[model samples]
Target: MYKHLVVAVDGSATSLNALQHACSLAEMSNAKITLVHVANPSEYMAMAPEFMHHASYEEAAVAQGNEVLDFAEKAVQEAGLSDVVKHLLVANKGARDMAQELVDYADEQGAELLVLGTHGRSGLMHLLMGSFAETVMRQSHLPLLVIRSQKDEDE
Candidate 1:
């Protein structure tokens, strides 16, 4: 019954799955869907200096973020949802994490629901990489719908 839903997309399969769920819900509820992608410049800063120029790293990050948003928007449109908005969130010089930016945007948008996808990592991988979805769940005041990645058993 939510009117406005914000979805986090990172150009990953898991995130696409979350988009699919959001599309279904949006279709049912006739709600507006806002797709948010956070471009963290710090991620590019971590690259070895010899590999790429410092300034180019930030440019690459923003470029990739735009590409991600474009792809997500296309998917939503293809899913027959026209009430869609896209946001490219940039994390300013490591001032905030992706989750915080997303949560803040959702709050600013007055979104009734926030959706995300989880890679479902565990143990060492989970501990090392950490989970943004988990962080958003903890930080967001709105209701959250998490779509977990579908993994093959064989691997």
Candidate 2:
């Protein structure tokens, strides 16, 4: 039984599904849920035009991350679980990737279970975009519960 669970949320439907699953498990075990959203400025920068301001982009990324965490926390509370913690992690340049950050945070939180949603991309797409869930699984020392994207199944 898990006493503490760390879940990654990115304001995506898949992430919401993962949070829902985490809530169910938390209810069963009376575990505390720690919701984490990584704000990777580098990702935003990569997508932004060269003329865009870095400071504004970073701020936007952090703001979005906070919004995602707030939404996830509300969902957890609405699920009737009060023991919830939210973290907005900023991914620095030349540092660990988002997956590593999540894994490290889970370990720091002393979580028994790490939960996340995966887009389930395969073949060319998977190779090009890579799988965040897969990276986390490889780096994490604790148990992981991966919830595949419902959209993928629907398609």
Candidate 3:
């Protein structure tokens, strides 16, 4: 079974769902898990294109990522993830595409599997907007477990 699992989380409900799923899978498999949050480099690059040459934007992204990562860690801890290890990744703009980044992270962490949430966007919307999860799914070298998005409760 999967011994090393990598879970990519983004604080979305879908991601949280996948996180819970990942935790359960880890528990059942007695596997080591790594919870990772990739601070989308696009956020910083889109906000400060000119600052790409400097470390300010990258630093800010990592700082913000740390907060999100902390929240994720709290959640995994609350779930009682005993064999899980967490890695908070903050990729700067020009670092890599989301898919490549996730793959690299998994490889670097020696994860045998990747778990993630999908937004379920498709058709013209998907073509126009694109999704990180989709990219990761298309490119990941390891086995990926995808949790599809659930419609909003009110919807």
Candidate 4:
């Protein structure tokens, strides 16, 4: 029933799974796919010492983000999805607001579904890093399908 689908990727296996799932759903429903990769340079810039090169750090992050998107798009195309779109966004740094940006972009694009994967972090790791999927679920109105990471499922 969904016509527009948004899938977020970050060059992680979990995200790769999400992309594959999105591709299958899109193919089945004849929906369009939008692959989004967000580059938040602020975290890197802030953490680097003043002596380190800032421009190179930001450039590397953007390049990596684009690579992630490229890989995701390739996988989708191989899955027989034709109407696929890609977006590489530079989000505000340090706020851990990628969730809000993804939600906003999906809404702006009139996406019917937002698909992503959770690393299933817990304990200290969860407390320190937080969870993007949880944030998006709490803030977005669009339907979400969050796939657990294979590692998590195995455990």
TM-score of each model, paired residue for residue: 0.90, 0.90, 0.82, 0.88
* Residue range 1-155, candidate 1, lDDT tens digits: 99999999999988999999999999999999999998987787777878764368768788889999999999999999999999988886442377889999999999999999988889998888787888888888889999988885213
lDDT of prediction 4: 0.86
Estimate the lDDT of model 3. 0.77
Worst 10 residues of 2 by lDDT: 46-55
Task: Compose the digit string of candidate 3's lDDT tens values, residues 53-98.
Answer: 5467667667776776677778877888767666667655432465
**TM-score, structure 3 vs. true:** 0.82
Residues 9-62, model 4: lDDT tens digits: 988888998888898899889999999988887656656476554366677668
Prediction-by-prediction clash tally: 0, 0, 0, 0
Candidate 1 yields a Cα-based lDDT of 0.88
How displaced is residue 113 in candidate 4, in Å? 0.2
Per-residue accuracy of model 2 over 72-151 as CA lDDT, tens digit each: 99999999999999998877752247788888888888999999998899999888888889889889889999999986
- Please give the TM-score that candidate 2 achieves against the real structure: 0.90
Q: After superposition, how far is residue 131 of candidate 4 from its true place, in Å?
A: 0.4
Candidate 2 stretches with Cα past 4 Å from truth are 46-55, 93-96, 152-155
